[model samples]
Target: MADTPPPAMPTLADLQHWTWLLGRAQQMMIEQGFDAMRARDPVLPAIPGLTDPETLARTRDFWTDSLTLWQRLLIPQAEPVVETPAQARDKRFKDPRWRENPLFDWIRQSYFLFSDQMLAQVEAVQGVDDKQREQMRFAARGFLDAVSPSNFPATNPEVLEKTLETGGQNLLKGLQNMLADLAKGQLTHTDSTAFEVGRNLAMTPGKVVHRTDLYELIQYAPATENVLATPLVIFPPWINRFYILDLTPEKSFIRWAVEQGITVFLVSWRSADASMKDVVWDDYIAAQIEAIELIRAGLDVPAVHTIGYCVAGTTLAATLAILAARGEADTVKSATFFTAQVDFKNAGELLHFVADDQLALLKTLTTDGFLDGRYMASVFNQLRGRDLIWNYVTNNYLLGKDYAPFDLLHWNGDTTNLPATWHLRYLLDLYRDNLLVEPGALSALGVPIDLGRVETPAYIQAGREDHIAPPESVWVMTRHFKGETRFVLAGSGHIAGVVNPPSAGKYQYWRNADSVSSLAEFIAGAVETKGSWWPDWIAWLRDHGAETVAATGPRQPGEGSLPVLDDAPGRYVRAR
Candidate 1:
């Protein structure tokens, strides 16, 4: 018998044409599914302006834009017939092919036009409350972002080109990567193998001086000849690993603080599991108090300077309030808050997930005693879906590209679960009820906590672009405090803004000497200083009462009254 004829390999044009058809089919199915869902249960509930004349006008405008876009596509105009307000700045359409190729250009423009109209409609709905409006906007954006042409294999020019170049091998590899990520139960944002907790990432030299079921305290070996008489303790957010502040030598805030004649201690909160199901807010507060007492006893210091980031900062405020109730506010000589919000009135996008209905749903899901860290991580990723979620979806799943080693992303992906009791109380008290700002409205460790009575000198830093904790929200914290407060605004988002080191010289920070009633007022009067805010913060610490003393060595296990457990970036932080 004659040998079977070999199959012909598809050409680039053939593949492109077929893929375009496939992409259109996929898009049509998606649209049909969305329409059906909307029909069954509308995306937005009945609000005052939803079906009013203004909504009718918006519908007309949307149709007008759609018709104009179709006309432009047929006529091949040099200029776009319709434009979105965000079209110029949208990074998703940055590829030249998105503009040069007529089909892709139309797709990109049409997507933006629809997205803009949907968002505008959401905004125009007048009767809905702020929270509802925000929820609608967030949902609209999420759907629009998910359907962006750049995310699909067939529509994305870069992905298509890569597929053609590799003769479908890219798609095969991408499938494999997707499967691996699915197995892991979370998306891979960076090369996980490139970094390790103790090796390259959290390499700051220290020893775990104290350990509890709640946390491990790491006392860093002094880096200077003379260290501050008053030690500094850092309470990083337990939502993620504590290594964010100790990523690498260049980026490690712990190392930098130790080098600057400050004895540094950091709390690495244990990642909650089913075993920690009953851990509540008071337990965390107690843990912080315990750490403070341990530091005082170990270092022989009367009081310690304390720093807290994110949720930890909120807890620290509560702890301070409790201490004030006990007449022990002086235990913390100075308090520094990094992107922490004591007031959630304008807490930003995070509030979207803390709505009453959402909380009820979350409670049901956390019947296992805790909310999985991956769930929280996914929530955060969805907040910046275009970058953190879809961007990786395209690179790792569509284009079959490997992620570059990003210490920040690696740390971000290393999440920690929230104990069910602690999680619900936090969301209810701080986010849903906004009770933290109300004097004696909240209590912890059996004390009626009032932030107003906590007179500890405070240094509060807020990120200008922090979506998690808006600058306004952080600014409102100053109003709750009775003591002298200095508010400094940093240049970037939550992580970069707080983790910024002086050596990198990346982003700028703003500082104002005079107190301001609002964030806007602070910005108007503030001076824009180049470089990181770390030095300015250090200087503030020194002024707050940090006297120099002989630097001490790392207190190994059994060497002191506060027994050391293991090493820096201890087991609590290393737990999965």
Candidate 2:
């Protein structure tokens, strides 16, 4: 029977089986997710009209538009042409004509402007939905929960009974006003530029130092005298603002390290301009290399410790690898990455955006200009849109919840533009190509990023609750480094994890070669810790610090009382 024609592969029965199985599986997943959420918060039952008829059509339309854009305009443009030679494809990104694309530029501009308009429209709508409003409604419901009702007068039986008689009419009015305030504050921007004046807090009093030239070094003594000997230089991502690390006097990591006697210098990257648009990834690494040299020259230190945070972390690893390949590893003592991804093999949901098609579209958009901050923010917002983005929508717009103004949120909303050139290069070379992980994949600024060549002792940190950089994906650092390395899983999301103050209550789970059998096992046994991760890190640095030298004279920049900026966390970042 001709071996029954070898039987048809992927037969009709197989196809039908797969179709039914897939349908059932999808249904199960959806039910499971809903069940989990409802179980955790009984208030979820209030969403009985989740699919209200009035909003149903609008919601469907929104998804349809979104899916269409995703598949056609967005997806095709962002996808990477991996099968082709990366070097040749990379060259296409260099053409002057590519930067002039209108669609690319329009979307970048429209993303931010449109986002602003949409948010405003939603805010104008008073009665959106009731049940959805409670999603973000934070208040004390009982005495035993996170918050106590006794703290509020209404919790008392006498007051509660009286309030009930009035049908809570007075309470409702106050709630309306409070909710309005939250809605407005959610997208509020403030001008704090005045705060960028030269003022340094002191036990005594001293002239403040302000170093402006990108090449100039700011010299200040960290309060501690017995600090770590490894010359520590910090590289902060320039995406938002520089002061995230030095947020407040009490929470500043720079201040903390200084008090611990660790020599620390942080890079305050200039907000890039049109001129900087011509600058590529190579220039960035080159700048870092130059900074290292300058720091070494001034300190006369044999080697230095390098710390990179978020995007800066990946930048640091890339620079170290390039330097190492050039036989300059001796200049580097150690390296630490805070929530940075060097291994892109599993870039998580983020990869969905930078996938070949979306990136190609973004490339077209950014051809003539920088990736508008609004566009970038929108992409990130979409990642957890239902929670971070939409939950706020329900509370602020629908329920009129009021949020007290917070410096952190204020800074977060203050967006920064990205140079179109640098943004494209980052996407093409790092995100989509996965060059940093692949040997010789990316040759940035004429130097290849050889992770195996990065011989500096490394400490890598990933956050357990980080949606931006998940633990499983970020832990890839364990396999990439060629030198002595330790990987840590921190407690919070990307921003909270880093800014975690000693007062912050959370414990991180992690595994090290010396302590645990494997990263998975360690994570499984992880326990909660009280207080910030900063103290533990300070202790780590102390153990690594070289013997303290006689307190050296303050290394002021010039004779005329070295010019001081308003303060360490000054105006450059405080700009609205």
Candidate 3:
């Protein structure tokens, strides 16, 4: 596979080149759409004779409703569905200047009408798959969203109000924010001061005991006097920092586990740079094994309970399969998969972007040996433009507001560059081909990776509304594990579903004691439990952790062979 080598780093020239290429592709697609529309019948069907009573009655009712609507509009009444759930939350529109103003309301209604007509036209396009059609619809919506009257200073009343209040200082700050982001390749969104790693967030108090070119292992200091006989080590996706599991003392799952009388260790993958372009999937696999060994040797335990979240879990599942085939599966006593998908058959709408043309473009762009983190983030932002993108546009440019202090959003904005070789391998072997879930169809580290060979029992949790890794895809992971498996249908989405603490008592979890099956049957047989699924997970942990020992806290950093490199949230995690 020939690759387009990215320059040492993205230069202005490189950015402009790729931007133009993308624009060209967009233009071609637009031309194809216009031609398709022009080819369609522009003539209307013959009108029904008014002699028909049903047609005459419908015409009369339409005139009556029009008169009623006219009277209501005169009274300044807004239709209930005029503003969708998503649009209703826009504070600028909430102002009387937008709603009470009849002209603005009329414009809003007209815009919605145009949007509906364009979407209908996109749907009527023939000889296309759902994925292709969805892309067209998404593009149409994006164009409409970009031109929203609220996004402009002249049309947005809120921006005018802010200008009046601050004497244009708000606009100046907004320009500052925009320039700062542009300098960073336009990846930033959240306010950097909102939360600092190892200060207010990711401060669960752990030490980096092992460091490698690919990853670092952090051994968290135990909170309880007596800890579980076996240690619990976590593997988080390298796409972002692992601090999400240790965000805050209140919401940190790692903290909760330590407090539950269990020793905890976290695997933190290093943020790569241009120099690390040669890194590959095998490197990450080796890193996982190295982490397990370091934790096992440091804690003086023969085996450890393992948990993998998102893509990290997918790696773990494959790792376990290889280990089981090698008769070394004892390294992991039990397993847990959180919002992870091993199968891509139903990975969700994101798959639409993986088609041939898109993949070809991605390949060209990533030939630089590493895919830029900002580039990846931009693509993901398009998947949920309203929440991930347009919302920020409104707040940053329209409202001229600094990013609100949000830990989750902050972490989301902090993305990592991925090695090209490894990323392409993943996209092809897993997402595109879906070879991971198939028995005897894939291999890793020269060993055949058959998920059915994995005898390690697992507990899997799926979010109710996860679009990236759909719940159905997560549930499909249970089919390969040979041991007992418990599937939990948790309320909420990918991140919130996994991070929900019982203390908050917000979302509920549904548990089905039966074996692995379709998501529908599982939900039908499941029993709903209010609060987080952490307790049930803890119970399962206790069951796996049969023998207890007198609570000697976790091994200190630099204990024995694995030396403590630095304090928790090491330099790798703190990297940009």
Rank by TM-score (best first): 1, 3, 2
Report the backbone clash tally of model 1. Answer: 0
Off by over 4 Å in 2: 1-217, 364-368, 513-518, 525-529, 554-567, 574-576
Candidate numbers, best lDDT first, in rank order: 1, 3, 2
TM-score of every candidate: 0.89, 0.63, 0.83
Candidate 3 local lDDT, 319-388, one digit each (tens):
8988888899998899999999889988986776777787788788776778878877887787767677
Q: Which 10-residue window in model 3 sums to the lowest lDDT?
A: 44-53
TM-score of 2: 0.63
Residues 363-423 of candidate 2: C-alpha lDDT, one tens digit per residue: 7766556666766766666565544454443334323345554556555665666788888
* Clashing residue pairs for model 3: 4-367, 5-368, 6-368, 226-551, 558-564
Task: Tell me how many clashing residue pairs each candidate has.
Answer: 0, 41, 5
Best by TM-score: 1
The sequence of per-residue lDDT tens digits that candidate 1 reaches over residues 399-466 is 88877999999998888999998898888888988998888787777788888887999999999899
Full-model lDDT for every candidate: 0.85, 0.59, 0.77
